[model samples]
Target chain A: MNPKNHTPLIFTLLGGLILLFIVSPLLGMFLATTPAQLFETSKDPEVVKSIWLTLWVSFAATMIFAIGAIPLSYFLARTKFRFKGIINGIVDLPIVIPHSAAGIAILGFVSRDSVLGKIGSSLGLNFVGHPAGIAIAMAFVSIPFLINAARDGFENVPVRLEKAALNLGASPIRVFFTISLPLAWKNVLSGLIMMFARGLSEFGAVIIIAYHPMITPILIFERFGAFGLKYARPVSVVFIVVCLVFFVLLRSLAKERKSHDA
Target chain B: MMLKLNNISIKLGDFQLKNIDLELERGDYYVLLGKSGVGKTVLLEIIAGLIKLDSGKIILNNIDITHEKIQKRKVGIVFQDYSVFPHLSVKQNIAYPLKGKKLTHQQIESLIHEYAELTNITHLLNRGTQKLSGGELQRVALARMLVTKPECLLLDEPLASLDVQLKGDLRNLLRKINQKGTTILHVTHDYEEAIALSNKVAVMHDGEIIQKGFTKEVFQKPANEFVANFTGIKNFFFAEFSPINIARINGKIEIHVSNHDQIKNGKIIIRGEEIIISENHIDSSATNNFKGKIIQIIPYFSNFELIVDIGIEISVVISEDSLFKFKFKENSEAWVSFKSSAIKIIP
Candidate 1:
């Protein structure tokens, strides 16, 4: 090997940049609040309720995405059809739009002036200031991550495998469950984690949709406005910790899946 | 015949399987010979009911199974990739088709053991099927098919991905599979495989089975120019019967034609096997002998494919021993021979 080979230097530079970019803000968040302060804020009754609502709604939204998007993603990946490009573009539109813009668009559908909102109110159910609103907002912006990841996973499955399964006396549905789904499960799982994380951090969309019953992000925002950074930083620290733990567990799972596949 | 196809047709975006008619006798091996993109695999899938026909009927044991679902069709498929389930063990993969059946666990286990033994992969039962080599994977795949006891096995380039030694071994394995009362509809673009494995061969071109017959009939008399060329028939050139049978370009050589069955307005064919490469025109034994210079010398396994540049480039295949003895090489002078009877004068 050449002593002057540039690979290690290049890799070190890239690795250092990514480490600094991700770690610095997270470190700041952690350092901003002491463990004593984090524990003290956990006793705030309002803060506890908002965080509970946020986690549950985000979890529900993520579960719904898993249930619906996996099959539909496989379809988009495997099918050869006219207007597939248009359909794919439509699926990815939420990701391309800013979260605030996505919220504004959702507002157009569920505002009191809109037909759906009128029908909802007539039925004695309201999207505004409800868990349903939070779920919808989380789902709208984050659904594409799960769908696209799952789609790419399904795409990597050779069509010949399906044909082989069919030839081996399995139906099309049987083939999907047995071969296609299992092979693509890792990518789908990673997508689910990413989508869940995306949903957890959804501030712009959820705030615009349902501002009163403040989610964790909205609570942090409210705390900052009402009680200043001293009150908000502790909750932010706890929220970051929860998000970090969830992600770390998921990251390990994803890593295990990658190694298993390899 | 266990399976018979009548004018089966299916069209993918660019490729079409047009008017393919085939008959597969009980335990018969029929190889679909074609170029890479000539819809050979598509036709096999259509027959297996994985692909719906544009306009056709597939008859299996006299039941019109044109609209049958793939699982209901009882066709086993081994793709070029073998398509073994990566997650499933060898036993599980082989025993996959038996999952929803009425067979007991022990029965399925014993069946897997039996087929595994037949394919000589019994030792790999607990290992994942993906860990097996190409030949091993194919054997397992074939064994998986065998357990289902399919009406016919559809193999698309079964040994195309294997090494030369493995391909030969797998070919033998495939031959053994065909012997075990299973009909095979094997597809390959390789002429040697088609010749070796198939009792009947279908030469496809541009999505159509242009010529199909018993292996010898199709090889001896290809129906058209495309089939002739595709199968290494090595026969070509313009000729007329009225002019005492002279090739269009070679005025120095003359040939006699009985013209028993003249086809109208087409180039005549002289099969490579029929063309004889000799040292000289020793007159007393054979006719249609002529002097020529070798243009190309291609070693074709058991023989040498000597191209005689007699104005029209007549390619003659001779034994390797003869090539070594005479040293008939590239750009060397040589004598060529063929009987007028062997000159397939296209009518």
Candidate 2:
């Protein structure tokens, strides 16, 4: 080997340690849970319901917000207007703010006396102390991942492609849907997956928003606080396993779609 | 006129175009020839309504389209990178513009098939654009653009990234496209491409149109030194011309000119092919003849390019037959002559 390749042994060792530091805890947690305990936790009605609710509601939130977020990202990517930086900063503000603070901030706007709360009540829906509240909290905290990813994807798409579409006599709206959206579909899908995953893992925000109808994270905290470490271990392991399965499934779907599109 | 740009001016980033005016009659092949960064692509974009112009009036077929939207302008553009939609198959991409035009499915398919056959991309109809070579991509882009039947076509270096053989093929393809009644405005930096593919040509430099005219006229009598140099004329001198049309070059060589209506000490140009070479001085009607030693002889394709020292280095092109007859080599003396009409003043 060359001397240049020989000089960086320390860097590789340190990097390997960091990688181990991230992987060891997950591996240990998975190893600690017995199969019987995992089966018992999975059979519990409350735990199963909470896990199902968490996955579906987070998926629902991601799907709902993407309708607006994807278009907003495409607009941000393609246009140059005044205060664009300010708009970008506003998009990123949710990620930077503490999640608990984000939860509290959302509560102020959706409480019973607020305008959104009154509108929801008028329509026989309540945002506070409801699953809708949990969905909102999860979406609020995780949407920046979707927006930033989609924006970057749009930026990578060549402007000439869009121009070529317009030159072909397609309207601006048609160009966005057919050309821009499809070209950036992989990034948008990845963003959706990230947002969905982030929403699934939300704790500080979702717990504060709707603690009564518990998500998996809140259920894990409640079981640990009330019972003991053994009771929460199997639930945590099961949730991680479920999340891992869905994450891998979605990622492979994205890869498959990308190859098909290509 | 099919398309006319009246006093178009635009400033994009650091490049500025000032008072660019051009006109194209119906079925004309116009080439915008310039070096890179001379705003050729920007001008094409402006005419296509892709870029907003600061001050201009575009009249296409006697209708003002200066402020029209790109799609509504009835103009199409093919980019240098082809810009074929990667997410769609070739057939889908070709039929993209006809989607909402209320055409029947059969009509769209037949039209796609027709254009595909026209551009010789019929075999690649179902293939993904990502798997295409540069030439195939260019043909697909042409098929997509031509399928719309736009009034005018703007090509921004469409053949720039292709190989020489592919360029020759696309050149014939563009001619065929033009023959079918589409006015073409092709932008390139190549002199030979301009001369070969266009009947009319415009030369741009530093964001301004330096000269625009018939291609043969522009090549023979460039309006300025830049145009002359851009048109591949290599022999140049900054000489002083007297009132009687005698030019003294480099404070040494004096040559008689046909026109000296202006001041002295300006630039003059002559093409290398215009210079005649002989071993001995003979009577000729040409105005200027100089006896010079050959400094270098470089073989250029089927001809030999001799760089001779006539006080200053002057390039002269000679055929293989003439080279064999003259038997001129490095350090050999020869007489070079050029007509007065061949000398062009950069005014």
Q: What would the TM-scores of all predictions be? A: 0.81, 0.89
For residue B228, give model 2's deviation from the true position in Å: 2.8
> Each model's DockQ?
0.59, 0.81
Highest DockQ against the true fold, candidate: 2
lDDT of 1 by residue, B1-347 (tens): 68999988776788777788889999899989998988988887788777788997899999988998777887777777777888888888998999988899999989999899988898888887656888888888888888998888889998788887788778888899899878999999899898889899989889887888899899887887777777877767656455544434344445665566543235677878777777777664456778889988887546778888875678788888888998887887888877777877655
For candidate 2, what is the TM-score? Answer: 0.89
> Which ten contiguous residues of candidate 1 chain A have the minimum total lDDT?
A162-171
Tell me the lDDT of model 2 at B12: 79
Share of reference contacts found in each model: 0.86, 0.94
Model 2 in CAPRI terms: which quality? high
